[model samples]
Target: MSQLQAEYIKRILSARVYDVSIESRLHAAPLLSRRLSNTVLLKREDEQQVFSFKCRGAFNRIYKLLQENPVSGVVAASAGNHAQGVALAARELGIQAVIVMPQTTPGIKVEAVRAFGAEAILHGDDFDTALAHALALGEERGFPFIHPFDDPDTIAGQGTVGVELCRQHPEPMDVVFVPVGGGGLAAGISVYLKYLRPEVRIVGVEPIDAASMHDSLKADQRVVLPQVGLFADGVAVKQVGAHCFEVCRQYLDEVILVSVDEMSAAIKDIFNETRTLTEPAGALAVAGMKRYVKERKVSGQTLIAVTSGANINFDRLRHVAERVEVGESREALLAVTIPERPGSFLAFCQALGKRAITEFNYRYADSGTAHVFAGVELPGGSDERDALVQGLTDKGYPVLDMSHNDTAKLHLRHMIGGPARVPSERLYRFAFPERPGALLRFLSAMGQSWNITLFHYRNHGAAYGRVLVGMSVPEGDEAKLDEFIAKLGFTGHEETDNEAYSLFLR
Candidate 1:
């Protein structure tokens, strides 16, 4: 081992974190293991007192600072998990703590800091701004600023995780995946693990949009990302820390990137296995492991993922759910062109055969051809989805695979309709079973009747699927439209005069 690795190992052994942090349990992810045909283990750092592994680093640094020189108080800047860790540490040591958090920080985290008996100050709009204010406060008030990452003591503190891993699972392991944010956690774990088990691969995982460590390693120097996506806010650092980058550059086997959808799917996988929800950043290692296994076609080996934190906003679960299917390759979004006629939808359904329809959207865009936005459930992932698309193409239907299209997934699905000049446009909402042939049944029932002008349906995994449809009805034939709907025998409500339709879709 090199001198730096030896030093980190020594520092990690003597780190003072047990007073404030627990030795989190290592869990075997049975569901993930079965699916991947490998033994998948999760380092359950999310079970810490502050619901993150950060408590270990935060406490270690604070303990060392107090040992060297007694301080009355300390300050820290963090938007989420780190602040809670710092606050919990200070409370345990009976010292005053002030945590400066971004204005956009979730209320749960801010309140969590305060609950830990630390004074939480909301300042600035982002982490950088809050960090600057924290530094200024530290200088003016004669308080030491506890860094979220980038400090030697902090890195050593995080390294305790590696120590526990070695003791808990001494069996052979093919790879250990660590999440990389500012790089402190990765650096700590990599140095210790690599020094002890040179044969074990230590891979760091990062968000593709916020891959500071990956970019820095490629450039052979720390490089700041111009901007970062906040979806995985915990690991969205612009630049890796100096100490962290140096250690990681030397010890880490490699770094890999995962997309937001992949992270979301990993979160779902964790929930399925452990019945626990993790933040996007917390699930990074799992996402990376999945990608690595698939890309390398490696199986029947031991793999570990560090589940870092669970400090997620409850509201964000909705967005996570929406993307998880796509992330898991279990859903495909497509734009298909079918002739603008009464039986086009039924023909499209015939083309799809027994495959389930997750979503369908249409509007009266053109009289020549109608564009349909659809989400098809995929039981067999990418290969199956490709075959389905190819099958549609063979039948003379033009298909645009929008599964990887950002705009199509995020915006176009919801905004596919607007005002149309159809002479007698009327809107109605319908509810039916969210299963195969359900849409076909609806389309078949309304066959060739009064020109279906608009249609939208999305399956939310509930027993019933909801749909909004617009139809062209001659002025004197309003009763006939009602009769047509009554005969269809589906539950629905008329929205022809709905305020939203009047303003936009009408």
Candidate 2:
């Protein structure tokens, strides 16, 4: 075995985490385990201090550093759990500590560092920027720099998780999924596990948009991403660490890239299984496990997925909740155009049986056409949705179903209405079947005569949904539009000039 791997195993065996700090409950999710036909165990590291396994490494590194140098103080840069870990470790060691964090970091994390008796310095916009500032300060102040990861000691410290995992489940595991940021957790656990149990596989999970480790492993060397998606902020690393990558290259079995949507869905699944909210990065292991089972077709093998952290921004939960169903393939979005006529909407609704409505948006101001945006629930699968869309098209309605398209979901759907026709003075809200061809029927019936001025629709994670629509019509066209709308059998309102709708559009 490599010296690094040997050292990591030795450190893991020797190190000791506070009894209260080590999480023991390995949750067995029957729903997920049954799907994969494997005994799936979750390592609930989110139960650790600072709500992350980072504390394990921080404490281990600090303890080792004190033995070597007996430092009076230490300095580090981090935006989240790392800062809290170092602060708590330094305070416990009776040593002064300084943490440099980005000014954009949440106030809660910043305050938590200070509450742990560490001096906190608000610096640049991100981890790298704060790290640069911290390094300069460390040089001038003569304080030891405590790296968040990358150091041998830190990697060894994190390997303790592997020791715990093995002790918790002595049975052989086919795979152990670990989330990778700078590759600290992955490298550490992989090194320890491979050395101790050569038969077990170690897989690293990273966000597809921030897959530094995946890129690095592919290149057979470290590589940096020009941009990283910050949705999974905790593991939004641009580059893998040199030390961690070296270990990963030697010990990790594979690296998997998971999408933000998959991670969001995994977070929702984790909440359902464990009733605990996890950050996007925290849920990555579970997402990876699902991807692995599907891709590799592995069955009857035990799997362990590490639940790494739970320090999620509460506001972002709204976005996750809205996209969860779609990610899970339970909802579909569609863009359809319908004839501007009466009774056509009702015919479209009848074609789509009991599916729920999640969102609806329509605009009727274009000189020759109107558009309707709709989101439908498919508690069933794609076949049912395709049937609904085809049924509407068979009835002579021109339907465009974009529910499965990502571009439409992110940009076009949110801004469906524009100044294609005369400006409208009024806005209206309406609801129709949240089915594939429902939008097309609604648009076709609105006809080429009326103009749409504004429209907005988003899936609100509900059964019956609502849509905000705006239209420009001639003074006497209200009766015609109402008459047309009433024939559709869907509830609609003439809020064309409503203050709230007008204000929101403006």
Per-residue accuracy of model 1 over 366-404 as CA lDDT, tens digit each = 888988999999999999999999999999999999999
lDDT computed for candidate 2? 0.78
Runs in model 2 lying further than 4 Å from the true structure: 381-407, 418-497, 502-506
State candidate 2's TM-score: 0.85
Indicate the residue-level lDDT of 83 in model 2.
89
The alpha-carbon lDDT assigned to residue 346 of candidate 1 equals 74
TM-score of each: 0.96, 0.85
Give per-residue CA lDDT, model 2, range 170-191, as digits (tens).
8778899999998888988998
Task: Give Cα-based local distance difference scores for all models.
Answer: 0.91, 0.78
Q: Taking the candidates one at a time, how many backbone clashes does each contain?
A: 0, 22
